[model samples]
Target: MQTLTGKTALITGAGKGLGKAVALALAAEGLHLGLIGRTQKDLEEVARQAKKANAGIEVHIKVADTGIYAQVKEAVSELVGLLGSVDVLINNAGILKVGSIVELPVEEWQQVIQVNLLGAYYVIHEVFPHMLAQKKGDVINVASTAGLKGAANMSAYGASKAALINLSESLMYEGRKSNIRVTTLNPSTVATDMTVNAKFTDGNVEKVLQPEDLAQLVVYQLKLPQRAFVKEVGLWSTNP
Candidate 1:
């Protein structure tokens, strides 16, 4: 396994759930964290906890909407300046709108696409140049199992994630020669507010895949040998 110590990773949606968990795990390995989230309070809280995990670990928090190009561009530029360079980019920010197509508000559907699909695009667009310039980096998009197929009341969310998976695939082929790894992870039944709302799981987090479970997997993927990388992977809850 490769050592990630002293590297830099930027994670979107880092305030809660898998984002927060991943940030902490990365901190444990001594990677400086550049966290992007919608809520400043949550971002600060995560940063605080991350600092506690390793006293010398650096945490930079940026409040920006990844769905917005201007915000993402500005936020990423500033973060890169703070951290020097981004070794890994995790596009984990997404929204779930669980309702029938007919019943779901048009605005909500648009919002889902904006945040889930467009958001990932904007972040990748901003960070790819850096990875390309360096000829080495990792880009992990946290998609969903729902994206793999059509499911009940998942029109907007499913469509967004499906597009994200395609996006990851295209980037994987496009960037592989440059030695930048682009991967997509589709996790099922994670015990987060999003999954609980979808009624796929409950508050008993341990009975299903927890946020840290998904977070740890992403870290493991990042540590693989430079000569080998998984293009895409999926996670499912065995008990669920």
Candidate 2:
């Protein structure tokens, strides 16, 4: 197993939920962290916790909306300068707007696509050169089960995630020669703020996935050997 002791990881949506869990998990393994989120306070809290775990580890926080290309580019540039280079990139920032196709507003649809799909592209584009220069890196896209299977009232969210899955596949093709590993995780019903308000068919939340479990998987993938790559993995609660 490859150790993460000296690596630096850049994670988006690091304020809470799956992102925060994954950040802390990587920190536990002695990885430096570069956290990006829309809220400075949340990012700082995560950084504080990470620093407490490993005092020698470097932590950088950037408050930039991933939806904007210029901001994403600028943030990545600054992060590379601060952390030397990002050894791992996690695209975890996402939004959900549930509505049937006929009832979905155009703006809502666009917003979902903008944040979930275009945002991933922006980050990948900005970070690709750095990974190429280093000739090795890990890119994990936090997709959803909605990406693989359509659901009622999830047209917008599902479409965006599906695009991400395809994007990750394409990235693997382009980055394989450079020794960059691109993996996508499709988790079903993670228990987060995003899912707390979601309208479940039977209002059954107990069967949903847990952020900590997903975090464990993220850390496990990070530790995998360079010769092997799990391109895409789907996770669902057995009870769900």
Per-residue lDDT of model 1, residues 93-163, tens digit only: 99998899999999999999999999999999999999999999999999998899998799999999999
Q: 1-240, model 2: which lDDT tens digit per residue?
A: 999898999999999989999988888899989999999999999999988878888989999999999899999999989999889999999999989998999999999999999999999999888899999999999998899988889999999999999999999999989999999999988888888877642366566787889999998898999877889999888874
Scored by TM-score, the top model is 1
Cα lDDT, all candidates: 0.93, 0.91
Looking at candidate 2, what is the lDDT of residue 101? Answer: 94
Candidate 1: where are CA atoms >4 Å away? 202-204
- Pairs of residues at least 3 apart in sequence or in different chains that clash in candidate 1: none
- Candidate 2 regions exceeding 4 Å error are 200-207
The lDDT of model 1 is 0.93
Weakest ten-residue segment in model 1 by summed lDDT: 197-206
